[model samples]
Target: MNAEPADQIRLLEVQALDSRIAQLDHKRSTLPEHAELERLGADHAQLRDLLVAAQTEESDTAREQTKAEQDVDQVRQRAVRDQQRLDSGALGAKDLENVQRELASLARRQSDLEDVVLDVMERREAAQQRAAELAERVAAVQSETAAAEARKAEALEAIDAEGFRVAKEREVLAAAVPDELIKLYDKLRGQGGGVGAARLYQKRCEGCRLELNITELNEVRAAPANQVVRCENCRRILVRTADSGL
Candidate 1:
């Protein structure tokens, strides 16, 4: 393949632009905010699950408390009815004695049910506290997550803008080069880590960071200016300049 000497230099400019774009893309992916957001997201999800569990426990305790209170109320109502019957004096001696004993039994039963109601109330209060604490934690995490997401968005937007600008410059520069040359460069870039061209400076192939051997240097020196030459070691297009030390 052959391209003008000037065109080969332009290819280096295109390579520089491509490298800048790649750097911007890497910055976008590796931004500190991306990792922060990931950590925050995991925390948010775990906290939400805990909050939901606490709320469910609170609801269950609430229903238990209600049922206990109803049981206490029913017992109290029965005791009151029995006491009224004893006060009416509408019974014989044997019947009055039985009514007195029945009233005593009802009082004991009511006391036991009231104790159960108190126990249920205490448990419900604890559950409510737990749920409240979990809710607050969830809200805090959500706020942090939102802030992280905003930061990530801002970073991505900046990187994308710079990448877009650099890409436009590369497109214009690459368009001026011969399509055949650009095609070969693109292929080599894909095969060799993103770099398709390198300058031969001080008898070194900058792409592979290796000094060209005497034989390779001689071959490159003898090549025509219009001919496209590749580095023997790295297989990258070698663009020579006055500093090549040839």
Candidate 2:
């Protein structure tokens, strides 16, 4: 498709803006804050799971401690009743012997129960400490996540603002080119790695970064000044300039 030479040059401007917009989009997607946020999110989830497990352990151990204490109390209460019976002098000799033996058994049971209580209490304390540590970790991860999110937002805002500006400039440039020319350029850009036009500087097609052959250079040199030229290698609209080295 043929466009005025000046119009062809405008295509380069539009292409530059498009390239800038593409770069901005890339920057937005690959922001360091995005990766950091992802890592923080994972850490937060793991910490939350640990906290839940710790809390469950704490609760279970607490229940065990409560039961142990209750057992100790029950055994002590039985011993107290036996002692009161002995003090009352209300039992025969054999009955008194049986009561004293029962009190001794109760004392052994009470000691065993107290040991169980102590063990459970230790477990509960450990669980509580683990839960506290996990909670602190969760809080730290949450703080980092929040900060990363804020940084990500700031980066996106900056990228979007620049993208908007470049897009606006592209709109003006695209309006200057004829419809058919713009259509061809757009199609080429889609298939040509985001470049639809390039400057022919020093006999090179800047789009493909390849120098044109002698025959191609001669053809371009002979082409009318107002006619549009394309690079034989990259098939992009080749904009000529004084430095094209025709």
lDDT of each: 0.90, 0.92
Say which candidate scores most in TM-score: 2
Please list the residue runs of candidate 1 whose C-alpha ends up more than 4 Å from where it truly belongs after superposition.
none
Model 2: how far residue 224 lies from native, Å: 1.9
- In model 1, pairs of residues that clash are none
Q: Residue 154, candidate 1: how far off, in angstroms?
A: 1.3
Candidate 1 structure quality by residue, lDDT tens digits, 1-246: 889999999999999998898899789889998888888888888988988887888898889888888887887888788788888889889988988898888788878888888887888888889889888988998899888889889888888888889999999999999999999999999988999999999999999999999999999999999999999999999999999999
lDDT (Cα, tens digit) per residue for candidate 2, span 9-110: 888888999899889988988999988988888889989999999999999999999999999999999999999999999899999999999999999999
Model 2: lDDT of residue 44 = 91
Clashing pairs in 2: none
TM-score of every model?
Answer: 0.90, 0.95
